[model samples]
Target chain A: DARVTQTPRHKVTEMGQEVTMRCQPILGHNTVFWYRQTMMQGLELLAYFRNRAPLDDSGMPKDRFSAEMPDATLATLKIQPSEPRDSAVYFCASGPGALDNQPQHFGDGTRLSIL
Target chain B: DQQVKQNSPSLSVQEGRISILNCDYTNSMFDYFLWYKKYPAEGPTFLISISSIKDKNEDGRFTVFLNKSAKHLSLHIVPSQPGDSAVYFCAAIPGTASKLTFGTGTRLQVTL
Candidate 1:
């Protein structure tokens, strides 16, 4: 089965440090999404890319968070000057198209802890 | 503003019984809805979905019912099993947008 792969399954960092999480979506998927999961917020969509072009990122903190799909296979989410509140399990999902009916497949999230 | 809401934070059901999970949405534009199941330390997996045009969709043991007028949906698992225990999230796609708006998940525990 083709699965989305996430790197550094766990990461612990101090406040003000930079944290980068990487994901490789399933092959042939054209849409990529980033999400953050926290106790209070559950799962929130941070950003998404369709055909390598960003379609929406209204959920992300513009000043500290950034998401990019450098290539079709790889997608990255970065937090500069990370804060304690930034600690959460970040997930990456991908789908075959940018259609509402297509279900996005997810990767085992990158759990980040900022102290 | 939370467009999607799952009022029940958790539910417990005995094995071989019926398990019903409910979800509601405040957005009138939401045209597609999905239910995802997640185990500890694992990403959520798609369980089932229903479109606004249809009232229900079923896949084997899982069935999703959508009430467009009420903006509510429910997931029913018949003959619930121990393996069905997990955190289930309700999500929706507004209008023609591809992004999903999710509800705070409801943890379902199936007791044997």
Candidate 2:
């Protein structure tokens, strides 16, 4: 069965450190999305990519957060000078881009805890 | 502004009884809606979906009802089982492969 895969299931870093999370979307999927989940906000869309091009990143902190899809299979989310308030579970999801009713397939998620 | 809203933060039901989770949306442009379920350590998984043109859709034990006029939708799980206990989220999209707006999830607990 095909599934979205994420690395470093859990990460703990000190404040002001840089953190990077990686995801491997299911083969053949052309759209990738990054989301942040927190108690106060639930699930917030951070960034999304279609056809390996960044479509939207408005939800992300422009100066601190960045998302990129270097290839069709790989997507990455990075945080520079990560803050304690940035602690939350980050998820990577993918779907067949532009499908009429596309359903996203999500990875297990990376649990990040910044001290 | 929160486009999607799940009024009930949590719901508890007795096993074998029916569980109904409600969700509301503020966006009139949403044409498709979906439901997802998440466990403690796992990501949200797609459960069911309904199109704006359809008022109701059913798949086995799960059914989704949509009311376009009110911009509301609901998920009904028949004969709720203990395994059904999890966080349920409601998501909506305005166009094809567009950014999905999600609601604050409702946690469901099915007890014996």
Candidate 3:
């Protein structure tokens, strides 16, 4: 019954405000991923961390978006000066290992709205 | 530049019929494919998966078929039920790549 836990199931903020989303991956999982889902773009991987170290963040906008895993249990995605276009459902997923055959388990997601 | 694509955005099928969802990938380096089912407001749940070496994998009423030569894969659900109606996503993992490249997803509706 282990699952990835995400905080703040929904968020609404004005444009230019900072928004932070948090995730707690399943215990003993080593890989964590952050993704954004939009009607136009579908689901896009924004960033991921393996063993508490970032493996990729190329899909994220470096100027305003940041993803971090302070420890194995905590992963966070923050958007500074968030804009309306940033509105989307942010999902956090975790797997047992990096590049393993195991499927990533996802959290319910945080629905963010930037006005 | 979508490496993975689910051409059909939606599908409707009668209950007790077979539901087939197709996905095509452009990346030959992809060695593993997976199918996930997502309900509204819920996370995508892993349904089934297939490796490059295998052509088919099954779990209960769900089966996944992979065609490496055609770079295509499909998910088949037998005796589709009302509860089976959801968005299904196809995802791929390239050789040694840690992340999954997901398709746009297909919304399936089972009608009685």
Q: Candidate 2: which stretches are off by over 4 Å?
A: none
Per-residue lDDT tens digits for candidate 1, residues A15-112, read 99999999999999999999999988889999999888899999999999999998988999999989999999999999986575699999999999
Model 2 Cα displacement at B80 (Å)?
0.7
lDDT of 1: 0.93
What docking grade does candidate 3 earn?
Answer: medium
List the candidate numbers ranked by TM-score, top first: 1, 3, 2
Native-referenced Cα lDDT, model 3: 0.94
Q: 2 or 3, which is superior by lDDT?
A: 3
Error of 3 at A68 (Å): 0.6
lDDT of 2: 0.93
- Give the DockQ (2 decimals) of all models: 0.82, 0.66, 0.76
Question: Candidate 2, chain A: TM-score?
Answer: 0.96
Runs in model 3 deviating more than 4 A are: none
| Chain A TM value for model 3 | 0.97
For candidate 3, what is the DockQ?
0.76
In candidate 1, stretches whose alpha carbon ends up further than 4 angstroms from where it belongs are none
Question: What does candidate 2's lDDT look like per residue over B1-112, in tens digits?
Answer: 8899999999999999999999999988899999999999899999999999999999999999999999899999998999999999999998744788889899999999
How many pairs of residues collide in each model? 0, 0, 0
